[model samples]
Target: MAASLCYMNPTMIVTTSHRSSAELWRQAEEWAQRIGARAVRRQGSLAHLCELHEADGVLTITNDRLVYREPASGLEYFFHPGMAKVRIHNIEVGRGDPMIGAMQLRPGDGLLDCTVGRASDAVVAAYVAGPQGHILGLEKVPVIAQLTIHGLATYEDSSRKVTQLLRRIEVVQADYNDYLPACADDSFDTVYFDPVFHEPVEKSEPMKPLRELADKATVTAGALQQALRVARRSVVIKQRYGTPLWDQLGITQVLSSRSSRIEYGIAEP
Candidate 1:
């Protein structure tokens, strides 16, 4: 459930902030080269820069964070823990998380996140899995992957425990469809997918930008088969409550949250 790299979009360009220093400029150029995109000097507003370069969007590297701006939508995407921090706090207070419950995660467990858009769920999973556990997230889009990689490495939460959990996650730029087949059977304790919901959640403002950038592909039968094979404990898929996806995938065991509209469909290998 991932798209091709951002470099696949020829209209994308990388640039430094308007007031960037020499080191930041150099870093921007390096990132541009790594992503196979043009590195342009910041001349004016992000929209003006996009217009000048005839690009769809601009990825601006600043001292604080990496920001991607889509001129048409005026949507800026940057990496933030978002709800993962809140979810982790809830867990710390004895208020359990639905995803943790669905996975029945244990210390030392390994989790493979198939569609790790922004990696909020992955962070939460890593926290529950503890120091002995390992979390690997797969994101096909190069820009999203890079943003997440940088954020997980650099972002520091007020809680040192949260920061440690974030650092434990490893982000890889690869589509799950291709990555899954390469992994050996029973390689991970749990394989998870959180594809962009077929029906959007109106109140999810943060998700709007992600949905625009992320691959919209639904979980395919073949991919589910691979997930089941690769998972030793369970494969959990996040979808809207009453989604036809569960029936379509022949998933009968599902965990629901009374307060939320989402459900986790679970299948054992």
Candidate 2:
């Protein structure tokens, strides 16, 4: 199905700055138009929807409110909707396997995924946290943002297993900067940053897709700096064996996720 889009009350807004909330929404709306996301319906304050693309889900501009709704659980999440050419990674392990990220989670932990991308990790984080915990996702690409929200929307009607899992998940289409400040200080126990995976190539640099989209994340830095500051416990940085999450964001230890490159970061105690 084609993705849908909406104005979420068409907030009292103005094009204040180059990248203000309204302006971002306007640009995002234009992109959504180019694609085919439609307005689904008005559920309370939010315009809930379905049929979203991956890029649509990543470019949201929320005005601080999280549009929390009841969740239903028994559904399998949908990741990467329309991308055709799947280039195989040299590593045997797939990047989206939730088990690889187990170390980044703890029972009852409130976790946030800043660089959500297609949001495979967000679904895993929510399931890992279980019932007592909460999962919040932030994506900034219009197509990806729509797809992610559609996943979250499906949770609203999940059966037994799905209901249990969906109860803890909250997904939104806002910039990390807007979302982070809205949360109280120390709101999360852990924050996860998987700054895309890059491997060496003989020619002069990296591979294609990862080399491209990995560099597009804005939330990674904001998520790292602010996620650490607002986290009550610590932050988890996911990177390939040799790649670093810059200088300031370092972990005390690592866990090999049964993959050659994908590694987990456990903050120092």
Candidate 3:
């Protein structure tokens, strides 16, 4: 079967800024058209939008970028590579980053990020991969993908390298399950998966939104097999340190941060 576009609730209307220029409104309208959401003027409150459509959330477009706000939950989620603190810290530290160690990346290695999440890893991977390398990110959820894409596009950072790396990653809305099998053998230097772990680590507020929104598919042996077929060097899976994925996938080599709760399972050909 072909990959399906993940669903976004139609009740969530796209609202624009009150002082938005004509050009800005046009762009916002285009965004609404693409996402299949109605474009409306911002009224008294965002809560009004929720009541107007009886929606769970509202997607707002300002001069800066696109943002999704769920009033009831008070959860706001958007992606900006510059804002990925942990990944940035890892990059700053240079050598002991577990993800960098797991991928074993060279200067020009191409990577496939099967579960992009906030594209944090993908951004770091792209930085490691260099300008010559390419990265493709697959996100199964439409709303998440769009939000991420918008953030990637609009976020401005002082560091030109980080900005360039963010632009280099191509985020597509498609399930990796459907996309992987179609790839030719050794299509990318590394195929990376970061499925929702069976165990939860210490809770962080930023991660809560991801846990709620991300695809909760269990990674199986079959999934690893497909990833292995696509990876020229190795297939890596990131999860909680003690998850069953290590045993299930026969991943004996686990590289982890001494201080962090996460680990990476490497399956090489």
Candidate 4:
């Protein structure tokens, strides 16, 4: 169970669970009691806002949901679009996380990290290939951009493994809608997307922080079309193991590590 509980305000508590799906709910309730904070479980995320006491806090059961939370980090990490939600296990940044562990990064290559929340994947990729390669992390939210820059700059000072390995990362605070055009045609080798994890519109929701952002940005097939447009090599979509992505898009399932199934959509040659 990967969960954290902290006081967001004098009265409210934010509990985050980033582990096994089955254990996430049980751990969330436990964290709430351990810290005496209000617990909001992020299950069946489809609505714009989950039930909350304040005007803030939206629903977020997927990477897409967090993107709307961008621009707001540090201390509370409020501006992050969420972490590098990928699957490539055994890599230090997101070790054992199949969503983060199953990445296919070759050495001495460049990758456009669509959402560089905490830069977990950027650091891991940089380490994998060495300094000849570069990673451009695009973020629309100012808070997340600033945090990523600061964190990447200071990463060397904190963890020797990451510090020596992450010198090639570049963090940019720009909406992808605007920046994707700047890249030359077929410029990048990979375009990775962890779109918001939303439930069917009618299901009951569990997370409150994600409610507001969901109202602002709707993660439909059209949004994903944008991701497909900007990539040259492959588009990687992260989702549940058994979930069928055909309803969302026509992505060919290409990789799977543990339970984090990765589907790839390659542009026509």
Error of 3 at 108 (Å): 0.7
Better of 1 and 3 by TM-score: 1
Q: Model 4 — which ten-residue stretch has the worst lDDT? A: 1-10
Name the runs in model 4 displaced over 4 angstroms.
1-75, 78-103, 156-158, 199-229, 242-245, 257-269
Name the lDDT of candidate 2: 0.47
After TM-score superposition, the amount by which residue 93's alpha carbon in candidate 2 deviates from its true location, in angstroms, is 18
Q: Which stretches of candidate 1 lie over 4 Å from their true place?
A: 1-10
Which pairs of residues collide in model 1? none
Clashes per prediction? 0, 34, 0, 30
**Predictions in order: lDDT:** 0.87, 0.47, 0.78, 0.47
Best-to-worst ranking by TM-score? 1, 3, 4, 2
Error of 4 at 200 (Å): 14
What would the per-residue lDDT of candidate 1 be over residues 1-269, giving only the tens digit for each residue? 33333324436899998788899989999888766678999998888998998988889898877888898888788888879989988988999899999999988999999988788999999988888999999987777888888889999888898789889999998889899999999999999999989798777888888788877778888899999999999999999887999888999999987568889999999
Which of candidates 3 and 4 is the stronger one according to TM-score?
3
The candidate, 3 or 4, that scores higher on lDDT is: 3
Q: How far off is residue 42 in model 3, in Å? A: 2.5
Candidate 1: TM-score?
0.94
lDDT of 4 by residue, 122-153 (tens): 76666665678777887654434554665566
